[model samples]
Target: MRISTFLNVHLVSDSTGETLNAVLRAVAPLFEGVTPLEHSYYLVRSRRQLDRVLAEIESFPGVVLFTIAAHDLRDVLVDHCKRLGIPALPLLDQVLTMWEHHLKMRAGEKTGSKQALDENYFRRIDALNYTMAHDDGQMVHEFNQAEVVLVGVSRTSKTPTSIYLANRGIRTGNFPLVPKAPIPQALLELNKPLVVGLRVSPDRLIAIRRNRLLSLNADATSEYVDEDAVREEITDANRLFERQNWPVIDVTRRSIEETSAAILNLLADRNAK
Candidate 1:
């Protein structure tokens, strides 16, 4: 069994660590089954925590990945990991270098291209930075500024979809629709936003809700996880979306990326009109 340990070193000033986390989370499943990997993430924002995580890395085997923000700290971590005989990968540095070289090469090879690509490139970087800061409800106002809003019952991939859209330069807000609860008055008047409602098959929903209730040590019985009630809630939500002309997405079969891409495509079509 090939076991590897993963460590994440963050910066106190790093505003985009959340975006890096999302990508790593999406790729985590790839390391399962064959090359077994056990990992722990350290959110190091202080010098004391950084020193502690570095010392801890010496006792663990395999890779040490630094989602580093500061250039000086990245050099220190890399040297330390190297001395400890662990492979260290600095993600931000590699990506930025790749992007810079790619754009520079493209500009040099293109005809009549202005130097204004720098502004666009930096803007994209800023967008990604903003995305990291806004992820996980940190920037709820940014969510409200989204061109697309995702509404779901719960665990229907609202958070994942929102993060995915953020990575692709789209601001996305998500709100869960509670059973028998009134829709937010603001949402009812959200004519400027493209709202998308998500649904899943009732059986699937029942299983998911039941598991959730059990995990929370709550009543996993009739009212909350009942199949009939779930079906009715789904139906009602679908009808509400249709009546309001909001695009509906069935998340039962689609992965988070696929569902997010579909929503983005829909928004793109609307913009084209």
Candidate 2:
């Protein structure tokens, strides 16, 4: 195995450092064996905050990525990095410049513009509230209000996927398929929402359940983690999906993001139809 090399990376943002972190994560893997040591500073809107951040950067001396909307603050950061002989980059400057050129206008000076309390932000909040309310088969009578409903056996990642979809302003809910329990009538009758079934391999399900049980300090010998029982559960879930004519996604090797993306595609196709 190749030895790992660590590189210090400084991320400064006037708002949440989500964009910087995401960009770093996307690019870091391309350089094999190089691990990033992240130093993230968020909400660097004031000069004082920027001063503290600069101190940290100077001490560590790393590649700097920032998304400061204030021009003066950005200038100070860039100049300081230049004097220190460290590389400083604005993450959104190129994209914003391209948009400005295309639209024949300069970008606004507003800080943390993406986090503004706009209609889309409110919509995402509403969707998140609805998702939390309807998670794990809760509020089944209101299932029709959801844009998408996920159905799956235990440990198939129903809850996390539902939340992820909700974050994208898609009202999502999920219901678990327990062994020997009859399917909820409300779920079966959800005509308005696109009901998607999540399926996982029996072996993967057992491993997940075993880890879950260990985390909870619960008995691992229960039928919940039994290989035969898990197999039967998955098979029954698959059959139910086929009987109901619902879309099914295998989550055995899929991340929550991947599963949610598939569900979004299914919802888009349904909407088109």
Candidate 3:
């Protein structure tokens, strides 16, 4: 039987006011094929909005998963969903239960590690903002602080990977590989951090390039996105990375999170050196 699911995550945050975005980011992989009918707002700052949201839930069809944390609000949301005859799943109910169980089973899951991770996360955010603000997407730097440097063609998931790495407490820098363009002289001398060059299959890169050009209302098919040219560029990039003894990862099937996790694992291994 084909299964269809709909999710309506109602996030509640008292201080940070970022619970919704956090939940969405966490659950992004789950909504790949599901259609998003609508998104409703019911901020805690506005009690009136909460009432309206409760009323609106009555008209909502099918299953709607809510991600609320406020006690009274959670009760109200569950009641409203039941009144509408819709299935609702609470956000942190079973998740925290399982997490607690896992934590109890693990060895040396100390508070110190958690605190260190939190501190590292904020530092990563600062670095990311700096990178974005200073980025021309072409300029190169010393990148001495980078734990791992990502090299890929345009839109080959370099920037997102860098951001993901940063979030995982790995300072990541990225450079684009343009065909026949000179790489920064400084980059050639880097012998410290592991450099991972990302490669996508030529056909996939062509499709991505085609969609990008069409979105910008530019030529849908050009030498820039030519399959042969992209293939050659990937080959050359791989050769360069090989010549420099940098590791290469074909990112054709990996998500940004997976790529970042792999990089972190590499760093962890290196630190044991």
Clashing residue pairs found in predicted model 3: none
- Higher-TM-score candidate of 1 and 2: 2
lDDT head-to-head 2 vs 3, winner: 2
Q: What is the C-alpha RMSD of each candidate to the true structure, in Å?
A: 8.3, 1.6, 5.8
lDDT of each: 0.67, 0.92, 0.68
What's the TM-score of each model vs. the native? Answer: 0.56, 0.94, 0.68
Clashes of each: 0, 0, 0
**What is the full ranking by TM-score, best candidate first?**
2, 3, 1
- Candidate 2: regions farther than 4 A off: none
**Per-residue lDDT tens digits of candidate 2, residues 1-273?**
789988889999998788998899899999999999999999888999999999999888879999998889999999999999999999999999999999999988877756667898899999999999999989999999999999999888899999999989999988999999988888998899999999899888888989999999999999998888888988999999999999999999999999999989988888898
lDDT (Cα, 0-100) at 187 in candidate 2: 90
lDDT of 3 at 176: 84
Please list the residue runs of candidate 3 whose C-alpha ends up more than 4 Å from where it truly belongs after superposition: 1-38, 45-47, 61-64, 80-86, 97-121, 133-139, 164-170, 210-231, 253-258, 268-273
Candidate 1, residues 177-201, lDDT tens digits: the string is: 7789877666766777688889888
Q: What would you estimate as the lDDT of candidate 3?
A: 0.68
Q: What is the lDDT of residue 228 in candidate 2?
A: 85
